[model samples]
Target chain A: MNEQRRDVLDLLAEGKITATEADQLITALERDQPPVASSSDTRPRGRAKYLRVMVDTLDDGESGQINVRVPLQLLRAGVRLAAVLPPQVLERANAGLSKSGLPIDLTQLKPDELEALVEHLDELVVDVDQPDAKVRVFCE
Target chain B: MPQLVTVRVTRVNRRPVRIWVPVLPVVLVLAPVLVLAVLAAAAACRVYRISVARALGSGWRVISALPGTQLDIGLGRSAVLVTIR
Candidate 1:
């Protein structure tokens, strides 16, 4: 199978595209020779993995939590976003919190800690078929 | 029994990791900027470490109704664990 066809098939497998949409993709792939645009460095091709995040509002006081199923590429995106801000915000945010008598140290967090605490996220891809497994995000 | 509450879900964009090393000389040289820089770096780092690579690409709609205040998110045939709080 050609690269475009392979990508279309992969999207089909991921349940990202409908039967009609998949047909359109396949048709387009065949017609476009020499590839009008390279899939790489342009935009990723294929059905995106999905992550379901929810905030529950309950009488038991459980509404601030989020649960998500993330792809590795999305995880990388999340990491990249998290890295955009400087490191001291954590300390400053925590410092303010501490001043208010909350005992938490944001400066003491590791990469994994940040992942666990983040409320938002994104994704990336490596190959057409060899995508990584899903990541589970749970708020404790 | 605790009833299921309303849940909010927001999609975040991909970001890069930011690091700020506060050396004594630099800190002494730049106090206020150093603090701001540190804050910026930390925020960037947090964004970078987010678990995106392995996450689902599309944004998800939160279903507030679920089993006992807890959410049993469907991941295909399998389910993932989600706490209400």
Candidate 2:
């Protein structure tokens, strides 16, 4: 038996969860996973190395250029943690941001929407070269 | 403080490179300003908390019911950033 399937049965045997809950968990796990990735295949697969944000900057007066790489994983974990924030805190945060005349409101930002945005962020490439400075922000 | 951040020393030039920018010394130099800013922000939070309390204050109470509340945010490799509350 598959490990998750077996684990569910074991939980039922130990009286840890109700049968209904076990069924739902098993169903969700089985249904939600990607069918292609889970299938048995000999093809080599490439895993994502990093969630990368690279910013290359240059200032005319500076001795050397500066390159900044922001790990995407940090952003990912932050979003996951934000999911646990209390609704009251989020509401208050929205009010506080509004008071500062900022358009950002955390309360209205949903996890799914944020996830979609993050996925799109991987495609962003920003490049600018000006007389004073050259700035770039992109995902690698 | 050191000037340039040294990584594993791969490529000296070209490609996207990650360099760490330390903000502690600058923050320390401006500590007094930061403290005043914090005080002002705290006062604002208190006012907001009170106004929010008048409506549905249960959340603040719930947070306070616990011994204490502390929020920490840190940035590092792989993890990038973390916030613990």
Candidate 3:
């Protein structure tokens, strides 16, 4: 164990702090540590494995959760598949998305370019907390 | 539950988006499934609706009305997940 961890344990053994306090300290220490790339990701290096979005809701003492894991490969294939669609279809799709307040233009997306973009977005995570719910979006 | 919705925003995109995909026909292909569910409900089959509503909660219901059941499928740049409890 590291010195910091040992210290926490020692304090616990001496009854200077409760188990819960020791646990909280250890958790805070872990949270403060810098992140290191680990083999646990199990994905091919430099390629995103999944796009994940999670939502947790708590209302009136009831709780619910959502977990979504979208494969990057599926997205890659979907992009390529877009080529088979007629141009008008793509145009109309973009128009419809804009009307829905999500103005995305697929025509400008090239697979390679999108791959590079995804590489950058792999580190992106967005979280929202409402009175009774939490939503998170990210890639892994 | 807190009566007032306290909104907290945290943007933590630690990973870069490596790919983006379009989902067009997925909608059309999925449409028939909904139509069938609707027809089943219209046919006086409360099984589908009851299960779905219960899952979404008495306030929450979902597919087949299975309680505490969840189904999540992710494809391309999008994902669809549903749960009922």
Candidate 4:
């Protein structure tokens, strides 16, 4: 019951505004105000520890599955390791990565960029469902 | 902080075989060797005009981040699982 909401209700009670108008006004007020932060929303983001990949498939009464969990720290460390590599090696790596359909430049990978990528990955999820197969990738 | 790694393998109509490996003692034993290796690597990096501190730091980070990794593969009636924790 904020002041704006109370004012709207008071106007409705006093017959200055109709109930429908009061409802619309309150809705508008809520839309205009910034969302209140909850405990979880206030917490810092990118607390995820691992990236997981899961796959399950069934074929002709046979089933197959695979699961993998990789620590996010490992990715950070790998980027750091790449930072120390020779320029020629990095150039070769970039070429290979590009050839493999990933146009990432190892030379341009910085701690800040890596952190931003991890933060974005925190909210990334991929799922595929088929008649006899399922796949999922996410961070947790 | 994880101290052990567990590996399990199962086959159709057979009991699961589990192996427990203690990581802490192994890590402790290798600590000195790792320090020496880092020092040698740092010297090498210095010759190459690379940052010795970053190299050492990254190496340590990789090793320390090895725990909590897991992998599982299953086909038909056989399965293999590896967990570090």
* lDDT on C-alpha atoms for all candidate structures: 0.48, 0.53, 0.58, 0.87
- Candidate 2: what lDDT? 0.53
Model 2 per-residue lDDT tens digits across residues A1-140: 68888999999989999999999989988897667554326334333323433333333443334444444544554565465566787888888888999868797889888877776676576777676555566665
Each model's total of backbone clashes:
71, 1, 33, 0
Candidate 4 CAPRI classification by DockQ: medium
Ranking by DockQ: 4, 2, 1, 3
Candidate 1 lDDT, B1-85, residue by residue in tens: 1132334322334232223333345547898996786567556545756333322221111111112233444323233443332
Fnat of candidate 3, please?
0.03
Candidate 4, residues A42-117: lDDT per residue as tens digits? 8666488899999999989899999999898877777667767888788998999999999988887776887778
Candidate 2 vs. truth: CA RMSD? 15.9
Q: List the residue pairs that clash in candidate 2.
A: A51-A72
| Predicted chain B of candidate 1, TM-score versus the true chain B | 0.26
What is the TM-score of each predicted model, taking all chains together?
Answer: 0.22, 0.37, 0.40, 0.69
- Model 2, residue B61: distance off in Å is 28
Q: Deviation in angstroms for A70 in model 4?
A: 2.4
**Can you write out model 1's per-residue Cα lDDT over A1-140, one digit (the tens) per residue?**
77888888899999999889999988887787665676454656444444444433232332333344444344544554444434565667788998999978756656676665342333422222212323343322
Among incorrect, acceptable, medium and high, the docking class of model 1 is incorrect
Docking class of 3: incorrect
- List runs of model 1 lying over 4 Å from the truth: A1-51, A55-75, A96-102, A112-140, B1-85
Instruction: Give the residue spans of candidate 4 off by over 4 A.
Output: A1-46, A59-61, B28-40, B43-47
lDDT of 3 by residue, B1-85 (tens): 1111121222234332332222234446789896786666445424323343322232112112223233453333234444333
